[model samples]
Target: MGVDLRRWWFDRQRLRGDLLWGVAGIVLVLAATLGGTLALTALFPGLAPVGEVGADPSPTVAADAASGLAVNLLLGWFFGFAIAAFQEETLFRGFLQNLLQERYGRLVAIVGQAGVFALAHFGYYPVSAWPLLLVVFLVGIVTGWLVDRRGTLLPAGIAHGFVG
Candidate 1:
């Protein structure tokens, strides 16, 4: 399996029906969130924080940021992004998504995948990684939804990077 990541992902895709619902889920989340936010802010004008942009002319932070960006790109692209996406979607969004979909509904499956995604990250460092638990889980649901829509994991992975 170590060398068969593409084949494994393709096989998994063949087994699951096209993932259109997954994409819808991602779109719904974004749309719903934006709509609710706008509605609430219109109703209660002073709720949202307005911040002024402060210019940072320091080259040190800029250099560090650029370097960090470079490193992240190298790792995110070259270090088997498809494999990582495949493994994650297979477990959280494939097997478990189906189970949740059958047991409850499509929403449940998306939520279940998100939950698993968060927990997986939390397991990496239970203490310091607590914050990731919430973040990745939210991301999981979005990715799961993407998988449902895209009919494959590759687009989902690419979208994840695009959003990041």
Candidate 2:
């Protein structure tokens, strides 16, 4: 049987409520990410490497970010709201986590999905960026927890979008 889009953790009747919760989730995740990064840096000073090669963006990227603020804004909004929030939550929290929770249980599913989520970023980041990976994994756990608690992907998606 094909998937029922109507039953995919989306409630049209609760759109306003979900949007409010989504905003709150975004703020919460932003604060958590910043605080967590600072805390980790304080605890492990070595994690903050100095004078890394290719750490800075290329001149082209910098120029684009500087001159194309409007374009960047639109693209960022689209990716954050549509791709990261909607698509990722649908895949990770709505489908994968639900299936795992059904087979293995909530705790295992949450952690397992989180690990997978973090690992999925391995190709994008360098291996030396362990602290970033840790933060990503923690965020995944928090997002998964939000989905489990709310029985919806809206807040999780919003939070994930903000994190991205």
Give the top-scoring candidate (lDDT).
Answer: 2
Candidate 1 backbone overlaps, count: 10
Candidate 2 clash total?
A: 0
Candidate 2 clashes between residue pairs 3 or more apart in a chain or in different chains: none
Q: What value does the lDDT take at residue 49 in candidate 2?
A: 48
Candidate No. with top TM-score: 2
Tell me model 1's lDDT, rounded to 2 decimals: 0.58
- Model 1 clash pairs are 19-148, 19-149, 20-148, 20-149, 22-145, 22-146, 22-148, 22-149, 23-145, 23-149
lDDT of 1 at 155: 48
Off by over 4 Å in 1: 1-72, 125-129, 161-164
Poorest lDDT segment (10 consecutive residues) of candidate 2: 49-58
lDDT tens per residue, model 1, 1-164: 24343542444544343344434454654554455446655666654222222355455587689988889887875543555655666666666776687799888778877887777776554453244345455667667776665545554554453333
Error of 2 at 28 (Å): 2.0
The local distance difference test score of model 2 is 0.77
lDDT of 2 at 99: 89
RMSD of each: 7.5, 3.1
